[model samples]
Structure formats: C-alpha cells, structure tokens
Target: ATATATFTPTATATATATAMATATATPTPTISPTTLTVAPASGTYGGTVNLSATLTSSGSPVSG
Candidate 1:
C-alpha cells in the first residue's frame, strides 16, 4: 500500500501604461506706422503751383 500526490502553484500579474503631452498657442504679428502730409499751409510761388502728397496704410492708399 503506497499512494501520495500533492502540487500547488499560481502567481501571475503585470500592468503599466501612461502617456501625456499637450502644447498649442501661437499668435503675434502687428505693424503700423506710415504717413505723408503736404498742403498749402504755407507756400509762396509764382509761375508754377502744383503740389500733392498722400500715403497711408491703415487708411488704405499704398501701391508698389
């Protein structure tokens, strides 16, 4: 008479995962300053009288 049997084994566990990244914001562009003025505020001429000046940007009036 001979009979003996015993066995026990159980162990398994694993978990790991993560991610984070964020960045978005860009806006910066401004330029203003362009003028040209000329009138008959003070002038003294004889024989020829013809003067004119006009140049603007934010007002519309500029052509290359």
Candidate 2:
C-alpha cells in the first residue's frame, strides 16, 4: 500500500498606515524698553552727577 501527502500554502497579508500631524508656531518676543537718566546730562569739569536706569520686560521690572 502507498500513502499520498498533501501540502497547503497560506497567503501573506499587507497593511497600510496613514498619519497627519500639525505644528503651532510661537510668536516672536518683543524688545523691552530701557530708560536711563543722568542728572545733568552734561557736566562741567570736575562736576559730579547721579546716574540711574530702569529696565522692564513684559511690563515687569527687572533688577539685578
């Protein structure tokens, strides 16, 4: 007596993926205004004057 063998083949599967992405942009920073004052913008020889300055960022004072 002889026996016969049978073979079965399986099919392969393929998948596709899609993705969407978005980015937000940041606004540019504005420069802070600085004011400097010196008593007696001009001085004579051997004269002394006071000096002061103010700095601000986003309406807040900056000090060091």
Off by over 4 Å in 1: 1-15, 37-51, 56-61
lDDT of 1 at 38: 69
Q: Write the per-residue lDDT of candidate 2 for residues 1-64, one digit (tens) a residue.
A: 9999999999999999999999999999887676543344566679986566566666676777
Model 1, span 13-36: residue lDDT tens: 898889899999898888877887
Q: Please give the lDDT score at residue 14 for candidate 1.
A: 94
Off by over 4 Å in 2: 39-64
Task: Give residue 6's error in model 2 in angstroms.
Answer: 2.3
lDDT of 2: 0.72
Question: Which candidate wins on TM-score?
Answer: 2
